[model samples]
Target: MLITSGNSMIQSLADTAFAYGRREGDHDTSIPDLTLHIRNTPTEPLHCIYTLSLSLILQGSKQVAIDDRLRICSAGQSMLTTFDLPVISHVTEATRYHPFIGLVLKLDYGLIAQTCTELNLERPSKDLRYQAISTQDIDTGLCDAMSRLLGLHLTPEYIESLAQLYKKEIVIRLLHGSHGMHLRHLASVGSPSRQIVQIVAWMKQNFAQAIGINELADKAHMSASAFRQHFKALTGSSPLQYLKHLRLQEARDQMLLNGLDASQASGVVGYESPSQFSREYSRLFGLPPQKDIQRLRQA
Candidate 1:
């Protein structure tokens, strides 16, 4: 009998990930396409970029808040984020004995487009983006596919030969699941959703540069009013709001990773005034930039 709801597969996958991860943070797996995330204790909310990816919880749970919208996902559940979103997220439930473990696969747009063409799938309409960030119970088939993907770690030699195939299988499974429509919309070209994605990519690459709504609207091939509406629909934030978050997040990273002072970081991320940067940083991070970096470093 095929096991659809059994915990054995999920548990084994967790064990494998834990054995490899061993430490208490995110780890890129031996398989280039997968990332292993482990947490031993509950955490404070953190701001980070969530890429277009599928995250499967193998043990414990997580709480993800995007644009103040919250979703809690636990073992046996999968969370799909279809865009690179600025999110506040943390592990809400974990322990040394049963650490929170997740296997995250970054979605490959090219592979998805190829699969859709091979399957003769049509693009989903723009309405699908409203449900882009979703959580649902992992179906048996998906769990089984994930188990197989994880097994490749045991035989490193097979990674080059089989990882891509398994990843493709996983994508195919996702395309048939509840969040399939969202993924389909993302892969289709010339749609409003695709235009939003293009605009988002441009913003990501050029967050430090000044941008105007009119320019963004033109890039999206929509009128200013329509662009504002569709941008919010796709990202849950207006274009400027999204750009603000992107700049602030990058500023934080600069402080944390590059050891830049708040003033320096602010200027680097295109904030014209240090005082304004501090205020916005405190508003988003719940602490001033200096203190937040100090706390982060100590932790």
Candidate 2:
């Protein structure tokens, strides 16, 4: 029962990513939280920061670089990112007819916490943060819950009344899954993830300028060394490594949206050394910035 639904959800999401390829000029695909769409295409390598969102691939495959770690997710697999970290991701293969596809459920932790309290579910102390969620199979409890909630997506009249119920069910399903274990980590009162959340907020608000670790640490209300250790424990990267990813990802925006050259894009993203920027950019994205941008434009 639950196993079957997991299979169905994966197949559905994968089919969606594949549909995106037929649109032409489709970059790496994405399906919003309420809806799922996927398509595949043979595309030049591309990269984007997987903002702390829940992503599940239904078909084809993708490779993701998370700081020092590398992860590959294919059909029937999913990942949840708790912190807003930098990531380099690319679809390995796809085609116009049967593109890669996926489903996304963006978890709102605040909503989950509130629901937990309302439902009389006790949260753990806020001093713990889990690193990763790797689940091999989706259980029956999770599958049925998702199906009912998705059906609700079609009912606007009952949406407001049912939102909290659906959202809470979604969290409960995730909590029961391997990836769902992070609810414990996230609830810890002063946990590294708590600080990481603060840092994530600050970074989003202040990504345009160079930032100091001391400043970030202060935002987390910790000493510099302690902040470094905890940040690495949760995000698997040094402060600078994380910052570099942010800058490079920002440059990707310029290339894809405004059509900027690499040099100009580098300047916009705060790169003083053009050659060094190019190397790191290529290292993360699998191509020189100009070529990738040009390819993106041509496609």
C-alpha RMSD values across all candidates: 1.9, 4.0
What TM-score does each of the candidates earn? 0.94, 0.78
- Highest lDDT model number: 1
What does candidate 2's lDDT look like per residue over 41-155, in tens digits?
Answer: 6444455555555665655667777666788776566667766766666777556555666556667768756655565554554553466433345555655555555555456
lDDT of 1 by residue, 124-225 (tens): 764444565889888778887887887788899999999899989989988988778888888887767778888899999999898899999998889999
Worst 10 residues of 2 by lDDT: 24-33
**Count of clashing residue pairs in every prediction:** 0, 34
- Model 1 ranges with Cα > 4 A deviation: 1-6, 125-129
Top model by TM-score, which number?
Answer: 1
Whole-model Cα lDDT of every candidate shown, in order: 0.86, 0.66
